[model samples]
Structure formats: structure tokens, C-alpha cells
Target: MIWTLFLALFFLETESSLTQSAAIVPQDPTLTIGSSIRVTCSVKPELNLKAENLYWTLNGRRVPSKFYTVLNSTALNLTLNNLNGSKQQSGDNLLCHSTDGRILAGTCLYVGLPPGKPVDIICWSRNTKDLTCKWTPGSEGETFLRTKYTLKYKLRWYGRDKECQEDHTADPYSCYIPKDLALFTPYEIWVEVSNRLGTASSDIITLDILDVVTTDPPSDVHLSRVGELEDQLIVRWSSPPALKDFLFQAKYQIRYRVEDSTEWKVVDDVGNQTSCRLAGLKPGTVYFVQVRCNPVGIYGSKKAGIWSDWSNPTAASTPRSVSERIAGVCDPKSGEQNSTFRRELKQFFGWVKKHAYGCSGLSIKLYDQWRVWLQKSHKTRNQVLQGDKS
Candidate 1:
């Protein structure tokens, strides 16, 4: 019985020794790039580890002995300075190895660059139903890791800070706020950016819904000639679909460029009209035109709101180039006195055929009576008076 008990104790000790392995202190550390770090590997006392037999490997390569110190026979310390983001983020494995080429223990090191503060934050709402905010990233925008941006906002008076879920904006740095908007209430908005390294926030921007109600870009922009004029074209477009039902006066702006030219000329005095006559354009030249709208007096607002995005461009050409005399009209356009007289006569006859107000009948009756009187008089009174004076 004593022999059997000693044998059982011996088996237990062997099993424990076989199971022993090196372990890392502060396993799997995460740190900022360029920061210094230290780690230790330790084994059970029974393993009889030696300082000369232990070594370190980083990313499948052996680490120099100058970077480590032997704390004791079973414990080895490794130090790394000036960690880089790319190397650490790629799951750099730091392993404690024995001289016999057996990996005892290992841990992954994660080094990253922190996000910088965001800048140039701008927010706008569409018809007061939704708000969108965009921003430029802080210094060194690229952090090697995927960065997350969240837009947070709250009413200035009372409300819990809320995260914006709809961030599918055209600008990558933008977020959408969809609900719980008040026209009169001012809102405080900001963006928070985070990554594995660290997090940063933008400065808070406060604004009212009405003051920033910029509508979508204008659509279905149409272009046509103004009457028969050669140098003029009329540009027309409808209000944004979201703001059409809202009571607001929209002022339009027009810019045009020749097909061959890269510069654009802006027409700033379009006022609140949906259609404006563009005069002084080159005749017979294809031109590209764009229009944008600024909504004013929205919901009886005394101040003007922001301008909407420019409409998708549209193209139009002026009347065929005309002789300098006619200022770009169709060729053979009435330029002479006879042509003008014929045009007037055609207009007169058109009036007679249309709404003459019985004036056509009156003119026909007077024409026959005047003919009969002139024939019966035999000579004019003015002619006889001139003959006697001679």
C-alpha cells in the first residue's frame, strides 16, 4: 500500500510537469504607435528554466537580447520602444521561445494611431424633416485602422444626446439626423471619431432648423429660346420636391458656359422667378447651364434660408447665328423695311381673323363707303386749294 501511494504521487508530479508552459503577463496588449511597452514571460518553478536558454521572437523573427532582461531563471522580460502602427496592427506575435526551438507562449501586440479632431463641421436640414452634418477630418486623417464616425446631437433646451444612424451622405465625413427636429428649437451637434487607438470629438455647433433648411438640388431644368430672339434663351426649373408643398419664395441663380469654354458667367439678378430670360448669350453656340435656388420667407420666415445645391447641368443652344443686323435670329429673318411692313400686315390680318371685336366688319363697311365718296367727289378739296394757290 505504501509503494502504491508513492507511485500515484510520482504520476501526479509527472503530469503537472508535462502541462507546465510559459505564460505572458499583460497578455495581448493594445497601445498607441511610438509608445514604449514591456512584457514578461514566466514558467512554473518545476520546469527548471534557465536565463541562457530563453529567448524572444517578434513577428516570426528572433528578438535581440539587448531588448530583454532575465528577471530570474523562469522569467524573461522583453521591452520594445517606438512601436509602429502598421507592424503592430498586423497582429505582430511576440513569442517566448526555448533554445530547443519550442514556442512556450505568445501574445499579439496591437499598435494604432489615434484619431484627430474633426474640423469644418457644417450641418443643414431638408424641409425640417432631416438634418445632415459633414466635416473634415483632423490632422493625419489616415489611422491605418478602420475609423468610426458618429454624429451626436441634442436640443439646446431639453433632450437626451442621440446618435445618428443614417450616415450615408455623399461626403464621406457626413451623418444624417432623421427625426425629432423642431423648427424653432436650436440644436447642438458634433461628431465623434474613434478607432482602436483612441477617440476624438469635434467642436459643438448650434443652429436652428429654419435657419439651415437647405433643400435638395433643383431638378428637371429646361431650356428654350425666348420668342424668336437669337441672343436670348429662357431657363426654367421647378422647386425641390421636398419644398414644393412648403410655403416659400425661391430665388434662382443661373450660370452658363460655352461648350468650348471652361469659365462660367453667373446671372445674379434672377429674383424669385422660376423662369428667367438669359439675354446677351452667344448665338448658335451650344451652352451648358446650371441653376440653384435659395428659399426665402419659408413658413413666413423673415430671413432667407440657405441655398440649395446646384441643379444637375442642362444644355441648350441659342438661335442659329444671324447677321449682325438681326442679333442672332434665323437666317433670312426680316431685316429690311419691306420685310418689317410685310410682318406688320400679316399681324394685322391675323388680328382680323382672331378676336377683332366686330372691328373687322366695321373696317370692311368703312372701306367701301370711303371708295364711293372718293369716286363721287371727282376731285379732292385739298388738291383744288393747292391748284388755286399755285
Candidate 2:
């Protein structure tokens, strides 16, 4: 009976010892470039065990303690900094053995390079005004190693290896291009990724900057006359290009001189649009007219193109009757009223006759006469209205 009891006790002790032995299980069975990894060894429960003599081997070569950490008599964590964990590292065995010289546990880590070749890179503008670049991210399977990526951009304007910018991000995909660069320039960009194992660069991508050109001008421009006394001509024009996004507010100027005068007068200080009238012309005298347009760009900067060639000058004369007074109502007030009424009647008759056949083929002399009289009548009425109000 005693022998039987002793034998049973001995067997139980041996079984317990075997069960308490340590075993190494790598957290990640597969390793990749640039990834940080941990390997652990679990030891069976044993009283008074100390973390001493834990050993790790990477690919048949002993990994120095500087590269790995041994914890609590069991766990071994290896951080292969900057070292790409690849096929060679994967085939190597990581061992955790006891100080007692018993092999507790072992596991082979398989490291691999990330699959897939670098893909094409593409670039675009952010606001149709600035450029941007982007690319696809690298991918690994479920057991993939963690990775960091960088994007490098170079401008062709700067020459080879000269203008390079680096961008670092956790994701492998996408980057923004710099904004507000000069229009009509070219740029080149590339991307790269690095893991513990190694680094790979993507193909270079090139892009060009282009201005959003305005193919058409604002549209048909027309002129109309306005104003009261002083024989002022009020020229008014309509807005061009109805499309809200495309439409640009513009500044206007009138270039005019007395008939037979060679020098041009510019009235450009006025900002944006298509109209201005000439004032203080002699009654019955003809004046020539021309118009120029100035468009405002971003930042309110003026962009002036060639001035439109002189429009066929529409001639206008101040009303002569307004200038010459008659007897009917001789009081200064009565004289002014009678003169204004006659001048207006004459101007109206002239305009009717001139435009009766429409604007086409109207003689320069007739048109000029009609315009002068029209301006004179309009100015006189405004002066009278102003005096009455005052």
C-alpha cells in the first residue's frame, strides 16, 4: 500500500512540473516592415519563479536585450525599431526558456513585405484656383504590421531635387496640394511608406496649373442717354453675361471730344459698368463718343484689356431755342419758360424726324442736330424742376 501511494504521488509531481513549464506565443504570427511587435511566453503557475535567463532568437540569431524586453519571468517583447520585419525574420524562432535550463515555449514568427506594387498618383485643384494631390494607401491582410507613410512633393518650377515637401500621416492615402500657386505652372509629387522592415516609393506624378479662362465677354453692350440741364448726356448700359458665377462687375469710362477734335478724353476714375454722359456742350454742337471697359479680378485688382475701338460717335447738340430767348413772356422767369418750351418742342420734332426712319442710315448732321436739341431741352427741364424744389 505504501509503495502504491508513493508512486501515485511521484507521478502527480511530474505532471505538475510539466504543466508549469513556460511557452512562447507570438502576439503576431506574421511580421511586416516598419511594424512594432510583441512576443509573449506564458509560464505555468510555479511558486517563487523569477524572470531570469529569458532568451529570444530572431531567425536563428540571438536578438540582443537592447532590442527586446523580458518581463515577469515569462514575456519577451521585441521592438525592432527601423528594422523591416520580413521573410528572414518570419522564419526565425523566438524562444523563452527557463533559468532551470528547460525549454518553456517557442514560436516561429513569419515576416513578409507588404504586397502590391505602387499605384499611380493623381493631382487636382482644391478650389479650381489651387492645386492638390492624392494617392491610394498600401494594404496588408488581417495580421498586417502597423505602418506610417509620407508624401513628397516637388515643383517643376524649382528644378530636380530642389523643391521638396514632406507630409507624414497614419493613413497611407491622400494629400493636399499647396494653394494659391501661380496659374499655368507644373508640379510633381510622390509618396513613400516605411515599416520596421523597409521603405518603398511610389511613381512620380506631374500636374499643371491652368487659369479659368473667360472665353466670352460680358455680352452685347448698348448705350442710352440720360440727364437734365447743363445739357449733360447720361449714358447707361446693361450688365453682360447673365451667368452669376461667370459674371464679373466691371468699371466704365467714356472717351469723347467735340466733333473735328483729334485728342481723346478719358473718364475712367468711375468704377465698373458701361455708361457716362458728357456735360456742358455748346447748343447745336456735335460731339463724338467712345466707350472702354475694365473688369475687376480677385483682390479688386483692375484688369484692363484693349479699349474697344471708337463706337460710331452719336452726335448730340444743345437746344438752340433754349439758348436764344423770345418776347412772349418777357419777365426773366416768363422768358426762361417760353424759351424752354419752344426748345423742347423743336427738339421733339427733330428727334421724331430723325428716328422716324429708324437709326439706320440717318445722316450724321441730322443725328447730331437732334441729339443737341434733346440734351438742351432735358437740361432746361431739370434746372426748372430743381429751382422750383429749392
Candidate 3:
């Protein structure tokens, strides 16, 4: 029994010794950028090692001998100056090695900036069901360390402060609260960031869920030509389906662009109308249109609701110019040349007067070309008539 007890004690001592490090001073230190530090490695007396035979490595790379200071026969010192931020959030690997390249002692060097005050904490709800918030990092925004960001919120009057679970892998500065949000009650929200160096909290914001609610994009956007009008197309869309049951008045915006172009022209005067006439479009050209909605006084809240995302693009084309249609109608192959020309000129003037409310420069240019052609056609007709009489 005594021998067994001795064996157990021997194993325990060995395990304890293995758990202890080789006595590196300033173990696992945290530091700011541009700060210097002095680290020391001490050898156990039983190891029979000399400090002079010791060397150091930082992040697996050998440190130059100029930074080494041999304090005694069993200790060695390394001084680093003007340290930069750590290469990783876990910290920089610093190891002391023997001359023959055996690891004697090791520690991590955490060199980075502290967390700054989180700024621009903005929160919005989806149909007043849940809340989501995002914030901008203070200053340069890169902490270079493993910083923790916590989003805390509560009812403005009285409630337990709760943390919003942050999905750092998805978005480091954003958090989503899925359900159980109050509608009319105001919420106090803020973000707090922390690291080993320091901590800072953002300015708290108070808002009701109804005040910041946003709905899905407007749906079923349809576009069509405005009845023989060359420069106009009619766009129609249904209000956001999610908010149809809610008590709110929606203001819509329409933006369109020519199919071949990337620049968009926005129409903001489309009050609450689901159908709007887009004018001043290029004739006989395809256009893409999109619409968005802003709910005003949602649930009788005084503040305007957030704007929904732009709807999917819908495409339509305007009709060709009146002159083009007239030319098509008065085909020379179907009728006598003199009679066809006369019919085209008569239709052109009447159609332009009826259709061209806001005539574009292209329409005026077409009219000028048609006038010159008409004068030449009349001269030719007179010549033909004279020849027949002769």
C-alpha cells in the first residue's frame, strides 16, 4: 500500500510540474499600438541551463541578438520597441528558445487598439414585428483585436435590459431581434464595445417600433404605353401587400431609365397614386421602371415610416412618333405616290397637334425633315401634272 501511495504522489508531482510554464515574465501581455515592452525568460534550476545560451523568437521568427539582454546565468531578457498591432486577434506568439532551438518558455503578445465608442446606432423594425440595428465603429474602425460588441435595449419606461444576439460571422456591427417587440412603447437602444484595453458605449437612442417600421418592396409593378403618346408610358403597381391591412397612407416614388442607359430619373410627386403617367420619354424606346413606398403616419404615429426597398424592374416601350405612324399608314406601294404623300402630310399635322403635348426636340426635327420633303414632293407633283397635260 505504501508503494502504491508513493507512485500516486510521484505522478501528481509530475503532472503539476508539466502544468507550470518556464517562468516567462509579463506573461500574455496586452498592449496598445506603438508601445514597447520588456519580456524575460527564466530557466528552472534543475534544467541546468544558462541564460547566455538562450535565444528568443517572435511568431516563429528568430529575434535579432541586439534586442537580447542576459541578466544572469538563469534568465534572459528581450526588449521590443514601437510594437505594431498584432497580426491576429488571438495575439502574437512569443517564444523563448534554447541555443539548440528547443522551446523553453512561451507567451502571447496582444498588441492592438482598444474598442472605440460605437456610433450611429440605427434601429428599424420589419412590419413592426422585429427590430434590427446596425452601427458604425468609432474613429478608424479597426480595433485589430478580438473586440466584443454588445447591443443592449429595453423599454423606455421600465423593462429588463436584454442583449441582442449578434451574428459576428454575418455582420460584425449588426444585430437582429427576431420577435417580441412592443409597438407603441418606446425602446432605448445602445451599443457597447469592449476589449482588453477599454470599453465605450454609444449614444442611446429612443424610438417606437411603429416610428421606424419598414415594409417589403411594392409588388406587381406593371408598365404600358399611354395610348399612342410617343413620349409617355403609364406605370401601375399594387401597394405593399404586408401593409395593406395596417392603417397607413403610403406615398410612392417612381424611377425609370431607358433600357440602354444606367442613369435613372425619379418622380417624387406621385402622391399616393398607384398608377402614374411617366412623360417625356424617348419615342419608340424601351424603358425600365421601379417603384418604392414610404408609409406616412403609420398607425396614426406622427413620424413618417421608413421607405421600403425599390421594387423589381418592369419594362415597357413608348409608341413611335406620329410622323412615323403616318409614314407607315401612307405606304407608297399601296396608293398613288401623289395621293400617299398628301395623306401623310395631312395625318402628320393632325396627329402632332393631338399627341405631342410636350414635344421633344426629336419630334421638332422630324417635323422639319418632313416639311422639306413635302415641298419637294409638291414640286414633283406639279411637274407630273404639267407633263400629262402637254
Highest TM-score against the true fold, candidate: 3
Prediction-by-prediction clash tally: 0, 31, 0
Q: State the local distance difference test value for candidate 3.
A: 0.83
Q: What root-mean-square deviation over C-alphas does model 3 reach?
A: 10.1
Tens-place lDDT digits, model 1, residues 1-390: 999999888866543332267788878777777898999989776677785679999888999999988898888888999987756345678888878877888888877778999998888878778888889988887676667888888899897899989877566699887887888878889889998778999999988888778777777899887544556788998878878776347777889899999998999788877787777677687888999878777776666678887888899887654343234444453567478657646755565555455663656434333323433343365467669999
Candidate 3 Cα errors over 4 Å, as ranges: 1-21, 45-48, 166-168, 321-390
Ranking by TM-score: 3, 1, 2
Model 3 worst lDDT window (10 residues): 12-21
lDDT of 2 at 192: 72
Over the stretch 1-390, how does candidate 2's per-residue lDDT look in tens digits? 999999888866554443357655553366555656666666655544455456656655667778766565545555665445444423556666555645666776656565333466655442234444556654543224444556666557774542224342543466544554555455666777765446677777765443221222334434333322334555554433432243255555567676778877777775665556555554444566655443335223233322323344555544333444322323357887799768766866666665665655555445446655665665788789889999
Global lDDT scores for all candidate models: 0.77, 0.53, 0.83
Better of 1 and 3 by lDDT: 3
TM-score of each: 0.65, 0.29, 0.77
Per-residue C-alpha lDDT of model 3 across residues 24-121, encoded as one tens digit per residue: 98989999999999999998877888898888999989999899999998889999999989988789999988778878778899998988899888
Residue pairs in collision within model 1: none
